[model samples]
Target: MTDLSKRRLKTWIRLLGVTRGAENHLRDYLRRAHGTTLPRFDVMAALWRRRDGVTMSELSRLLLVSNGNATAVVDRLEADGLVRREAEDGDRRRIRVRLTPEGLEAFEIMALGHEAEVDAILSRLSETDLEALRDILSRAGRPE
Candidate 1:
């Protein structure tokens, strides 16, 4: 039992370190290559997925962030003409936000770069290694 616990502890630490390292690298890559922050990129990605738009609260929930954090990023995007907010028909207080055409174009470009950056970071891993890691993660929990 102690041996199993030790092994699991080591595995968890290694997994966490690698995840954090990759995330940090992507964050820096986005900032330097696209002049965008990770939070902004995340918000744009979520909006891109939901073309019809989502309420501000929904966006916050999707991003797993506080409303203030989500709103601040949205505020900046709106000022840049990258996003537009519209009030719901029946409930004026429920503002739905979506990417403008320009925002879509911008996010598409950034997403391509983001993919490339991730690929580069993980290039050392063989296809078999990646597949095995994916399987393990899938078994562990969420599928994201």
Candidate 2:
């Protein structure tokens, strides 16, 4: 590879490693402390942010996950009585997933916990370094 190409590849690999470690640690924390998984929490967060509820397609898109994966998370949430899946009013073929009262309560707790955990993790870096890293990652999809 060219010098630039090798550097870019190395950057990608390092970013992936850091992200994987962060995700694994957060997932384990949630499972042990909240009895929840990352995917389920992500779904709940998406639904919580939207008052109108969300379709499975939308959830898949927002979560950057597969349709089957979103469906499985919804199934587990429904089984736990935290979320309810219903047919859309205008289109019976389309289903919407909404959090039940219990789900909202659980999500509130999880959200707060997650925010603190994320803050703690990011707090290791100085503000300027954090901003620089954010700037670099924000340009990830831009044309070089």
Q: Per-residue lDDT of 9-121 in model 2, one digit per residue for the tens?
A: 99889989988988998999899999989999999999999868999999999999999999999999999999998899878889999999999999999999999888887
Q: State, as a TM-score between 0 and 1, how close model 2 is to the true structure.
A: 0.91
Give the Å shift of residue 35 in candidate 2. 1.2
Q: Candidate 1 lDDT, tens digit per residue, 2-119?
A: 9987997899899899999999999999999989999999999999999999999999999999999999999999999999999888788899999999999999999999999989
TM-scores, each model vs. reference: 0.92, 0.91
lDDT of 2: 0.92
Clash count per candidate: 0, 0
Kindly provide the TM-score of model 1 when superposed on the true structure, using C-alpha atoms: 0.92
Give the poorly placed runs of model 1, Cα more than 4 Å off.
141-144
Q: What is the C-alpha lDDT of each candidate?
A: 0.94, 0.92
Point out where model 2 deviates above 4 Å: none
